[model samples]
Target: MSIIAVVGDCTTTTALALAAGWPSGHDAVILEADRTGGSLAAWLGTPASPSLSTIVANSPALGNSPSTAWSAVDAMVRHAPSGTRFIAAPVRSRAASRALSEAGGTLFPLLAQLYEPTIIADIGSYAVADAPSVLFSLASSIVVCHRQDAASAGAATVRLERLAELVQFLATFGVPLTVALIGDRPFGPDEVGQFLTADGQAEIVMHSLPVDDLTAAVFAGRTGVSERRLARLPLIREASALARQVAPAETDRAPDSSRIDQLGSSR
Candidate 1:
């Protein structure tokens, strides 16, 4: 089973959407731990309520019914259009941060039980060692999304530095981290990756999500056009290739692998 943990900003939700749409019925879930903008809900079609919040608040009493929990999960799943399943975090990422701080590596395996062999987490800036958001230790693969310019590049560099500092922290917990760099279309994979690494970056196992029409599909909530185009694009292909690196078999892959659009490199 591959547990993909994403650590980045709110745009991470869009990344998850892309991951979901990579193929039809990608058996994946999103933990909308980013509580600031309700970005996950925005991506999930308009939600009826903060039911994820309610569930986290009431889980102890409700026996944490997977059926009921799954109800909320289902609502968001509808917005997905792709075959991905998701659950926003208990509250904001900060709250989940607390849970992570207290629990160590507990939430992922339990959540893993409810899904398929592959799991993708839209983790935020919480990859740090002990301040507490989420742990990189739980990830089979850790993808960090960032831009290429100095500001974003600088941030990515810091994150890479932090990820290194905390390697042992996660290794102790059984997490294997492989870092990737994501950028928009204006930036080429080689260009962004090279600039970032020019200064001797963290041996970044890096690649990028080049800007293209697919992002428009995500925003308009009708990505079929972009999805079709991207099904052949290098960004998606590289993502698939990386995904397969960690998880090879079809069952090991997200549902997107089954799609006709998947590029050879992706598989």
Candidate 2:
């Protein structure tokens, strides 16, 4: 039950689209937690009925208990054509935006606790505000998606600095932070990661998603490509790789007998 927060310096919709294609073995949900708004409803051509706005507006009646709050969030979830479930952002009214500001910190912390499904949240860009920064404390993994070219790379560095600042306060939890490069370039993931890692700018896991316009269109609901065909695309393959890298199985790790014995003794 890990919460993987996908955020960026620029638009993260494409990154979210790629993430939505991850090979989900468990129940997975994409949450549009961007305080500004979410475009998933429009992209998937689904009505914004059960959205974040709906949950926030109903929060008052739902009571302050974690169960009630989670119930409200659960009810708002809608499944996409791609088999990805999501809670959309507000589109019609600005009230939902306000709701996110007022209660986002509290509500999302509860969702992060649900262990059944892996919550891949499209948190948009990082912000200094509590609404967006709260996830830095709760998320098991934080992927800062950014463009890889020269210009955007500079901006990405700035964004990473901001993210580092936020994570510093929560470092004791050992949250895994990653920088996911989106777009094509001569630089490989390791090369870019090395440059960023130099000078201890910030240590981060590096991942890449090649620019595949066709696959992007399919994820954006712009094409009529079948799911099987879409699955074969380079975009999907890279996303799958990134997903596996970000969340590998516990069995893939070597056993730490000493740590196990220590835990046993403590118990």
Which one is best on TM-score?
2
Give per-residue lDDT, candidate 1, residue 243.
Answer: 56
Model 1 agreement with the true structure over 125-179: per-residue lDDT tens digits: 5444335444354456656555334357556566545544544343344444444
lDDT of 2 at 217: 62
Estimated TM-score per prediction? 0.61, 0.76
Instruction: Score residue 140 of candidate 2 by CA lDDT.
Output: 84
Candidate 2, 1: how far from true, in Å? 4.5
Instruction: Provide the global lDDT of candidate 1 against the true structure.
Output: 0.48
**Which window of 10 residues has the lowest lDDT sum in candidate 1?**
258-267
- Measured by TM-score, how close is model 2 to the native structure? 0.76
lDDT of 2: 0.61
